[model samples]
Target: MLPVFRRRPRYSIGSKLTLIIGAVFGLYLLSVTVIGYVMYSQYRGFSTLASSHFDRAMTAAELTRDAETIAAEVFEMLVSSERSINAGNRRAENLASIYQATRQRLDAVDASDVVDDQTRAELDRWQQPFFSSLERLDTRLAAEQSLQAAHLNRIDELFLLLQQLPPVATTASLPAADQRFVGHALAALSYAAAALSAERPGQIARLHGACQQQLQQLAALSLVSKDFIELRKRLNRTLPSIFTSRRPLLQHGRATLATARQTRVLAQKLTSTTFNYHLQLKAAAQQAITVHQRMIRRSLFGLLLASLALITITVGAVVYIRRAIVLRINRLSAAMHAHQQGHDGPIPCEGHDEISLMGSTFAVFVEARRQAEQQLEQANLHLQQMNAELHRLSEIDELTRIANRRRFDQHMASVWRRALREQSPLGLIMADIDFFKRFNDEYGHQAGDECLYRVAQALAGELHREGDMVARYGGEEFILLLPGLSLAQTEKLARRLLRAVRSLQIPNDQAEGHMVTISLGGASVVPTTHDRIESLVSRADQALYAAKSRGRNRFCSAVADDQNVMVGGTT
Candidate 1:
């Protein structure tokens, strides 16, 4: 409480306007500075996160390609082994040769170092089962071959008897030689068909024809030509289905044993391939590591550069402000002191800030009062003037002259406190015009300002509480802080507000509907629950974003129930 000045003041409107503009611009600049630094930090973090995932994808692709190529080679080798076994005249020698060859191939392939233990184990599992099946087929084929040789010898003995015996007395009286020869030939043919079935007897007819050519000569000596021809035809028909199914069993054994050997070759190839790619990726990762390090270094350098720039700007601002504002204010303080002591002089005015406006206004008032001192002493006129100024300042938007963020903050605090004490819910709604910058550009600056005012007035009328208040909270963003309301109550209010704003239907070609409409987000919470004021406001802000995302001209509410978090009034 200083002594009341007997002098009055006059203010220069130009100086006052300039002061307001400078203060607003400084605040905007500071906010941009802080946001820029935060964004750069986030960008650096995201880049590092993405690089880590790239490394994993590269490793997986390299491993899969190596495994597939090796498995293919093993399949080809097994097919070759099966053909050689089927062609053999000697059973034991042929099987032994196949076993030795398969074992040698397996050993040679297994000896080479390739792939990891886990991959080797995978190859071994299929190999073991296949080898067991092949061993069983080999034993069966050997037994069949032995029976075939015995059947052939029995037929030859019958043929010898047929040749040495006396000729058949007559066709009606069948000789024992004739019967024995027919019986032996049938047994021989049956044995040959059974033996070939083990060798994938699908080709039995061709082999049977080869045998028949030799037997056909014997047909000239035999009286059983008709029976023999019938037997051959019957055997050929039965062989196809049996041989087709058995072919897979014989194929499986040979394939697995052959493929098992191929897996070793494949393992070596995989080891080499894996090692090669590993080297490549390691080199690439190293390069990436270097690049990452450089990026980190670049970020550090950028931070340093930003820090230096900030420091330089801050130093310049401090020096300039001291000369432009602080020193001027100090000079005005001295003039005010002299004026208070009944001496009057023009107050110093050099700055473009609120203090400078006051100085100039005071100097003018002092000059005017000097001209009319007797009248100034007559009434309490200065008190009224001071109150008017205070009221005007309180209502003035600190940033844009349309109700300050401070007013919103203060009203919100009061509304929240009352809502809590009463145990009634408070509703907070926020709205942001979509593509406002584009709108601002399409419409001139003056038009943009007019649009904001129109939107603000629309919202102001919708705030029903005596305790409720509407104010501009951010650039082109408005907040409606409501007291004594439920979420349903808030949403209903929001819907009405949206309709009212849409009714104005200001021309905004950029808007999807080609009409100016606001996207509203509202949050309502019973004040009984303890929560920070910032968090409540944040929730309302999120709801506003939801409304915008769902397309503008909509109202969304942040309401949480046991069922779900809500976007509008209901989930």
Candidate 2:
């Protein structure tokens, strides 16, 4: 044999490619890690700064809302105080509790680093006057309430004297002049009483003067009885006290009003200050975001320049290896494209290279894809079935197996809009199973549930119209939406529903007739853009209350020609 040359070591295309790719990848990974570390550090700093600003902003917003709520509650307390003194006291106590809690919150905010020094100083400045004004308001309100009570008691005493005089003046033993004096004194007392009731302090003062003069003339009379002298003495004591109390009551009321005005002004100023501070914090957060975004853009631009250089080096290396790798990859790519276009065939894999391995993987993937497609089709069908079941379950009551409140609400909204468009009458009936709670107590919850189910079914059976819908609104309560029905028609249907449930004869020892019956309230209204569905529901609710009040097992219409009428059921 010709001299056997030593076989040269084989360097495959993959080994050459690995060397070039590993160098390029290592350089790219190093640059990326360094850049990412720098960017992440900056991002973390920006996030912390922005988070602090946002937290402070949120705290300021909460302070503003609390201030507004306090102002509203104060105004409500003032208004309610005019009607009932007990109510006023309760509101005042509640206001005090709310104020104390708000004060604690303010103190916490002031002590915290959430707010800057300037904001903290402003808050401190606002807090002192606001708390002072609130304290003054509380004092004046208490004093006014106390004086009012004393004034009422004194007026009652004066009335008692006036009532005693009426009997004395009618005594026939008195002289005509003394009788005239007693009559004039009675007139002055009456005027004073009227003035007090009407809250005219000036008129009361004038009446007090007239009464005092009359009292002196009566005391000088020779024909005065023991009762007359006693009455004059009581009046003399009572009028001066009443006169004294009235002035102070009036003064306290004025002071309370003035204090309330000052408190409201301070509260509004606090709200404005906090709101502005919140806006400033928000702006600072935005500025931080803007600055961070600029830094990110600059970092990304540097990263992009480095990436382009790496890509240029990668392209030069790839061009050298293109003939070896690109031709085989293109062949595999064409096969994948054909497979995508529904031409499923085996990939022509020949060499033991990376491209050949990809071909084997693609073959396995094709088989997996076929199985996944079948599974996907089954999953889609199952999802559709589940969705339909969920929709049904959502609309049906689990306990009653009737339309639930959610379903009723949706239908009512749609029907309301339709009625508004057509300007037709829409009627609603609110019905309750009478003595259901007591029935639950007598029987058990299971029996109560059965009762509700039967009642819901009975009510639903009574509605023959396609547009009529009966739904279980809540526990033992059902609502019927009867569109296109007038009030008369609604009432008629309500009566039928009442009788239908009574006909069931469900026994309950707690209920009247020893049977379960339902009370129905019906309201009908012609739809208008100005009318709200809530108003219609409220009217029906009122009618339902009327039905219950007139004794259960009856139908009540809210209004028939501006009159409430109830249809009573015979036991």
lDDT, residue 247, candidate 2: 70
Residue pairs whose backbone atoms clash in candidate 2: none
Error of 2 at 556 (Å): 99
Candidate 1 weakest ten by summed lDDT: 562-571
Question: Number of the top candidate by TM-score?
Answer: 2
lDDT of 1 by residue, 1-571 (tens): 1223433325543464466557556755765675576567657655643444234324434443433333333333334444333532233234334434543443343332323465445545543543443344445445544544544454454354344433435433655545555554554455455544445444554555554553554444545556545544444444333334344555655554554554445445544544453454455446656776676677667667766666665676677667766687788889989998998676775544566667767867777767577566534477677887787688766444556787777777787788778788888888887678888899988888888888888877776657777788878888888787788888888888877777777888898778888888888787755677887788888888877777667777776741213343211
Give the per-residue lDDT digits (tens) of candidate 2, residues 247-324.
766667767777887887887776677676667666766776787778778777878888887888888887867755
Candidate 2 Cα outliers beyond 4 Å, as residue runs: 1-11, 16-51, 69-122, 155-186, 197-201, 213-236, 268-276, 292-571
Q: Supply candidate 2's per-residue lDDT for 554.
A: 89
Model number with the top lDDT: 2
* Clashes (N, CA, C under 3 Å) per candidate: 3, 0
